[model samples]
Target chain A: MQITRQEIAGMDKRFRANFINSLSGFKSANLIGTVDMQGISNLCIVSSVFHVGANPPLLGMIMRPHTVARDTLQNIKDTEEFTINHVNSSMVRQAHQTSARYPSDVSEFDAVGLSQYKSTLLNAPYVEESKVRIGMQLRSIQEIVLNKTELVIGEIIEVQMDNKYVLEDGFIELEPMNGVVVSGVDAYHSTQIIDRLSYAKPDASASSIRGHAK
Target chain B: MQITRQEIAGMDKRFRANFINSLSGFKSANLIGTVDMQGISNLCIVSSVFHVGANPPLLGMIMRPHTVARDTLQNIKDTEEFTINHVNSSMVRQAHQTSARYPSDVSEFDAVGLSQYKSTLLNAPYVEESKVRIGMQLRSIQEIVLNKTELVIGEIIEVQMDNKYVLEDGFIELEPMNGVVVSGVDAYHSTQIIDRLSYAKPDASASSIRGHAK
Candidate 1:
């Protein structure tokens, strides 16, 4: 099948969104946890999480235009702190529920039956059910003018996870954690480690490392 | 284990990079195909591709700071055309080899042994081995000042794929294509579709959609 720029522009609104969203393949499934000044908590599922820089340990996520009330973006701006929790297989249904539009006063954690976990060093609440939770401090925000979207960059301030999942070379073994990946807005997937190859060098064949998988 | 911000800042340089890169979980594995004005082609693996917006069909990728020569970024800036090919399990090793630091005169395609495919509509070369390929034209570029990374946004101009992989609702079934996902710098993963759920709504459970997966 071949789809051109003209055809894509002519597609139905919702159809184009679904088609374009899934074109990039599976995305990291994470729930962004934040809180307002009044201590009101908000949890929204986002799949745009990507690595930005490692020295400062920055992670970036895209936020849609504020055509409606964007509680998660607003909360992060006001507090400058948020938590990114990996959505696992067991909590897929509950995590999907967080996408529904709830009232400003309503807390998704309470509405969806997920617990809020607070760390001593960060102001935002983390999802207690997530096996991998990261506390981040807002580093920068860039507005994408072409589409009114905002790129939110945050520095990883704290990481809380099981020590068993951390490999000797600093890679996190996610298969044992049952970490889920999202396709489009509806599909969820579980992954298996095919292999972890050693660092690539010129004129050298990539070799697999043993005992890296948990 | 709990890693605090101070501790992360104090860790060794290479250790921190690996730890922080894998913290975000799995990422989309893709080989970006680009060509220079002289028609010299280049292929490099990138895990930073994220959907910017569907209305404009824009996709964004992060380019690390050009502390050293960045052939991929330079080629895209000069020509404003590129192709994004989804990496599959069969070509994992060759895809990883593209990440090696090859000099400007050396084409990774030749060095890594992948065929360059060109379509009539787009000037950039695509990977013939890839089951899914997207042709894109540069739309915008924004400089991330804090980290000196560049966010390159491109509009999806053409899409060529096997017709069977696309679902009725526009989501592409990746498992049948043997698409691979990358974790950190070296790990590759194969995914299994747990289920495709219907659109979320308030006061309702997410039910699986039948006949969505191939």
Candidate 2:
């Protein structure tokens, strides 16, 4: 079936939100951990984080700074520091719980039963149970004049994860860390490797990386 | 292990690239299909597309407009339209092959052996094999001066998909489409649904949606 924009606009509010959200395909599931100026910790599930560049190691996320993610936005603006923790398989429910509109003084980490850890570099709290945690410093914030969403770009100042998960060939095996992805806003999933292909060349067919297949 | 940015910069080039890419967790795997002025069709892999907003149904992507992805970027800019097709499990290898540096006159659709079909609303071709295809009209393109990457924003004008995959509650079941996601630049995987939880609320624990769990 083909759905026109007008038809989509006419759909029920929640239905349109769900339908539009799922259209982007699978999304990264990470908990954005921040701390307000008063030292109250804040945690929320943010699926918008995506790689911006590799050399300087920047990550950018779409945040409705004026609305939904105000706590995170305020914290990042107040402290210019935050943490991104992968929502591993065991932490899905607890991570999802972070999306609740907890009061600014209430720490989602405490309310949701996830432990907090502060890395050596950033003041933002990290999820202690998360296998992959990154300390980030605010690099820049650009607002999309279109719909009031802000583009929050940050530099990865530090990364803390188990060394065993980092492969010799440069890839980090996410399966070992139990890193999960989400569909729509609530469908959580873990992945099964379909094989990693080598760099593509016009004259050659992409083959599975050696020793990656059964 | 804790790796500081300084240490990350000192690591081998490819090692740093892979390690940093994996830090964002899983990414959406989709082929941006477009056509040049001469109507030369082009297809390329883009994992940077992320949901920007829900009301206007906008999607944004990070593109190095000056360098890599020049073809897809140029085509989208020239035509003011494009298609985003979910890279399903069966099309991963062929979709990855589209990333090769094919010349301007050569259509990647042919080189990669994926069939293309044009919808009534857009000139850009959609991947016939893609279970979910979206026709997008370029809304705005902003330059990320820091890295010369452009944030290409598009509005969903039309969506083509099997209505059966769209649930009564509006969540589109990706598993039925076999949608695949990427980790790093080349690692691809299909997902196993852990469960779909209900909306988060301050007073309750999240439970799997009825009929969505075993």
Highest lDDT scorer: 2
Off by over 4 Å in 2: A66-68, A210-214, B210-214
Q: Residue B97 error for model 1, in Å? A: 0.8
Per-residue CA lDDT of model 1 for A1-214, tens digit only, reads: 7899999999888778778988887799999999988889999888889999888789999998573228999998999999999999999989988888888788999989999999999989999999999999999988999899999999998999998888777778888999988877688899988888877776787788747543
- Candidate with top DockQ is 2
Clashing pairs in 2: none
lDDT, candidate 2, at A39? 89
Range of the 10 consecutive residues with the lowest summed lDDT in candidate 1 chain B: B64-73
Chain A superposition TM-score per model: 0.96, 0.96
Compare the candidates by TM-score and give the number of the best one.
2
Isolated chain B TM-score per model: 0.96, 0.96
The residue-by-residue lDDT of candidate 2 on B193-212, one tens digit each, is: 89899988889998889465
List DockQ, one per candidate, in order: 0.79, 0.87
